[model samples]
Target: DAGITQSPRHKVTETGTPVTLRCHQTENHRYMYWYRQDPGHGLRLIHYSYGVKDTDKGEVSDGYSVSRSKTEDFLLTLESATSSQTSVYFCAIRSAGGESRNEQYFGPGTRLTVT
Candidate 1:
């Protein structure tokens, strides 16, 4: 399993304000992903990074942005926080190869509340 952690385990913010969440891993994995978990919707992908400075949008990319400047850190920013954006955000690292190639190790979630 990969070693991962997320910052600001819980947060409350006003609508339209900018919010940023951070994810860090110690395994030096090449693929990192951001996903939001909400009622009924399950975990939906927000963005992912393949390598340092190389990123891509995911299924739920609107209003969300991600960056990876180093192999150990990934950041997710909400340009404008909204009520609908309130959810538990998760950071995951995919195993590069081997038996667990498709397996993803997740970090403790960051719970965000938008008022």
Candidate 2:
């Protein structure tokens, strides 16, 4: 099924402002993840959804929120952007079975800059 993408391949944000990034998938898979990548760090999950309206927070959910009302779209909104939020964001989709254990397929990436 291999289909997922992120928008705003690049963004310039202001501190204390709000920004939203969009992730879309055509695979119709049941698992989707939003992660931010930074130097010397792991792909910290911001949030993920297992099904429409079935959402859960992740380890680095602070200052960020997500919504998935449709199967193809996942939106991440930053309530208050900070300099620390400046990083690359990637959207990933994995098949439903753990046995598949497919590596996350990343978007070209959205490079966000907060000033």
What TM-score quantifies how close candidate 1 is to the native fold? 0.95
Clashes of each: 0, 0
lDDT for residue 92 in candidate 1, whole number 0-100? 97
What C-alpha lDDT, on a 0 to 100 scale, does residue 83 get in candidate 1? 96
Best candidate, TM-score-wise? 1
Expressed as tens digits, the lDDT of each residue in 10-83 for candidate 1 is 99999999999999999889999999999999999999999999999999999999889999999999999999
- Backbone clash pairs for candidate 2 read none
Best by lDDT: 1
lDDT values of the candidates? 0.95, 0.87
Clashes counted in candidate 2 amount to 0
Instruction: Give the residue spans of candidate 1 off by over 4 A.
Output: 98-100
